[model samples]
Target: MTEKDFVPKKYSEIIEQGTVSWQAPSNIALVKYWGKKEHQIPANPSVSFTLKNCRTITKLDFSKKDGQEDFEFEVFFEGNKKEDFKPKIRTFFERIVQYSPFLKDYQFEIHSENTFPHSSGIASSASGMSALALCVMSLEKKLNPEMSEDFFRKKASFLARLGSGSACRSIEGDLVVWGKHKEIKDSSDLFGVNYADEVHDNFKNFQDTILLVDKGRKEVSSSVGHNLMHGHSFAEARFAQANDNLAKLKPIFAEGDLTKFIEIVESEALTLHSMMMSSRPYFMLMKPNTLEIIIKIWGFRKQTGLPVSFTLDAGANVHVLYPEKDKVKIFEFIKNELVAYCENGHYICDSVGSGAKQLSEEN
Candidate 1:
């Protein structure tokens, strides 16, 4: 891609100074993307809900530099200078330069902090990378001032995918599906698109209460976990199962069939864990408390008839999902039993939301 393809000529007089910020939501996939190919492309199509409150907010200040380097940036996490985060961010910038050509021409000072806990089974990468992507695209729009809305979001999603596979989903609203699937319209392996079309009213306000079984970081990073999938014994079948599930789920989501939705979502969660267990390295990521929480949730659902279900990411934490109407009873159940299993009795309340948004320049 060329700079002319993105930046317009009329706004060629580059601005000397400006700050852009974006807050992008974390996403919890109902159908997880475990294994990936080169360039962070998903092996199978995965669907996720854009979370509301749990997110990462990033602010970027750019200054035009005479030397055209791949990247020159400073990163701060929370209020402190995060030297460890700089390496990853640098690598991300190098990879994204092709998509955001103007990125190579600026000196960036990026300050980012997450609303939810990082490295604790939450999709912090999704929110974090998507926020940075939004900032970079917003900066480009500042230069061009003529980029269309469709070009803005799509390219941001594409650039975010280069940093993190699941991050593409965080750029879009409600629900998004990534990976090329024949059954879904407008799906692509490079980016994510809205797959929640014709979504039932019942699912409009779905809730996700994250039970932190362990607040500590995972023993294995998701990168290493994904690498292990390269030699997984069941990798082929797992991908097939995911595709089949995606096909089965389209009508279920559109028809508002909660029971079938629960079945597929829970199975996908278990299958993700199962793949981990069956990997060539054969390491366990789920805790005993994870099993306890699942069993109790099952028993509670059987007894109370509340339509709540659970899904897990790459770590031991549990993301409890249910309709908004059952919030009272579900929170009650969480207080009485599930909290005991959680790490430090901590949990986060979030739900499906309308993707991410840009921030005003001032306080």
Candidate 2:
């Protein structure tokens, strides 16, 4: 669907005062999305495994506005008032107000918290923005009582993308694809779509153990990296490669080919870092310990003939991905051999998840 499809109709009812709460999960890209265009459109299609344990819970409280000319809201993170987060949220409101015009009619209080540490090298923007978007959509639902479930989710994802590109993929389940691709039915650059094709049982409940190699923030933000692609020498080839890898994944996912899955996932991870290193202003996100953990994973995988692989984000942390059946051995290997590379031996274990959920008042 196009962005115009998300513009809502006049509300038949009004919700002057109410609260909406939602929990949204973060996701790990199997095929990464590195570059983007204006309006946060992805340069190439990417798919991710939505995570269960690492998530953000957001509660949005709204009441009738008292003569405000602009968007009015307050933000609290982990029970502490965070004034620094307001600017980003304000920008989000400005971007989405055209689609959800009723936002100007209410004063909102956003209470948000994450399951992981604030600076654990994990990007909370995906889960945090998605949770906030779902809460906003929930408020919209109260205004337009006839809204369909499909539209609600699509619009929430659409809005979430404006806040953070990867957030669009956090609104849904085990596998979600963002960005338009000919092979992916109903794929849109505007939002994420669930992978509706037959997925083999081997991938169910796939595990991701994130080892915190460095909790410090990256030197370059994702926005800077994306902008660098504008004049990047190998940008076109990289975008094409992502699409080709995505196509190749179709059969691998359906047939449950662990070997091919490992090949693609690992290559994609390295390719992402390669791009960053090759950019005009070259930089590296992976620390020395990151390479150490990777080498150890390779040794353990080869020794046991298990399908253990790793993926990295725009930071130093490593996300170890493996099938559920290998969890016992893999977890043991991680704790025994790989945890030494982690900062203070900090790590988190998560598995494939079903998506975001709305929470009741009691929750």
Candidate 3:
């Protein structure tokens, strides 16, 4: 795409200066967003913390080019060609242009790098899409300094959601909530808000241990899993259970009661999986080792009387949640029992933290 077509007068003024960069970190859901309603918006509103260590850095450069009306772009994952990423790239650029249509013509030179394994299943899409959205917004701001931060984050999140369902949660820091509102076609229904604003004051000390049991990709994506849930015999019951769990956990989480939090999260996760099993054709993500780990955690809870809970995404890895005070005992138990099952399995202990941010421009 030619710069004349893609670069608006505002962006063109900035392009004459140089390139701009931005970075954002990945986030893990505490109350997971499993199903989507409209445009992959969550069925129930969910909350998550943007992780500190795992992140992605995105760089955008603009230059005059010959023969192109719309922007042309390329995406790479860890230096390997990622042809399939075109749709996500195209969607993201389209959203950006929708907000600032004048820049629809310029060709985009985009490069992104992840700090963690691409296929390790640790919410890579969350970080990648969030970073891309942030970089695009940063470029927009450089070109036109009139945009507000609220408008930037909300619009960026709107675009990010088009890329991946989980990406909207990564737009905010510390704690974020996606799908609190109903879905509407005019784009007024979907939005993300900070969890602290929605939840009670006493819920800040929550902690989670990501048990990297296995990094293998998931057999069923969230979209497929949700579709399966729709026709399953227990679909209604499962939805009711999710609603009940959400109701019960709000007060418990607000009170910062580790015991109640563990009970609710564990139950919800198991219920989510149970619905998966009840689906026609009977699919299950848990391995034999997965069951063993669950048993071990149950036994550890029985033995120590500590409040520790485990939850799984569509993948096999277990995310262990416990209070910070119990970290020592939890670490010892995991090292003794779970470490051997993994191929160089590693664990990351993190408490809730802020979402993605620009780390440095030098990178």
Estimate every model's Cα lDDT from 0 to 1: 0.87, 0.93, 0.67
lDDT of 3 by residue, 1-363 (tens): 111232344443434324556677777666666656655666666656666667788776655455647777666666666788888688666655755553454456667787766666576777788778777767677667776788677766766776676787777777676755322112222545665434444445456667666777777776688777556787666656655665566567566676777777777777777877888767888777777788888998998898777877666777776666777887788778877765477766666667767644421
Backbone clash pairs for candidate 2 read none
User: In candidate 1, where is summed lDDT lowest over 10 consecutive residues?
Assistant: 1-10
Task: Name the candidate that leads on TM-score.
Answer: 2
- Residue-wise C-alpha lDDT for candidate 1, range 1-363, written one tens digit per residue: 322354333454577778999999999999989999988888889999999999999999888888785688899888888889988888888887766677778888999999976755575898999999999888878777778898888888988988888999999889999998898988888788998457887788799999999877788888988888897888888999999999998788789998899999999999998988888878788999999999999999999888899999999999999999889999899889998998778889999999999995521
How well does each candidate superpose onto the true structure, as a TM-score? 0.95, 0.98, 0.84
Error of 3 at 179 (Å): 1.3
Better of 2 and 3 by TM-score: 2
Local lDDT at 196 for model 3: 48
Worst ten in a row by lDDT for model 2:
354-363
Candidates sorted by TM-score, best first: 2, 1, 3
TM-score of 2: 0.98
Q: For residues 1-363, what per-residue lDDT tens digits would candidate 2 score against the true structure? A: 777888886889966798889999999999999999999999999999999999999999999876758998899999998999999999999999999888889998899999999888899999999999999899888888799999999999999999999999999998999999899889989999999988999999999999999998788999899898888989999999999999999999999999999999999999999999999998889999999999998998899899999999888999999999988988999999999999998999999999999995321
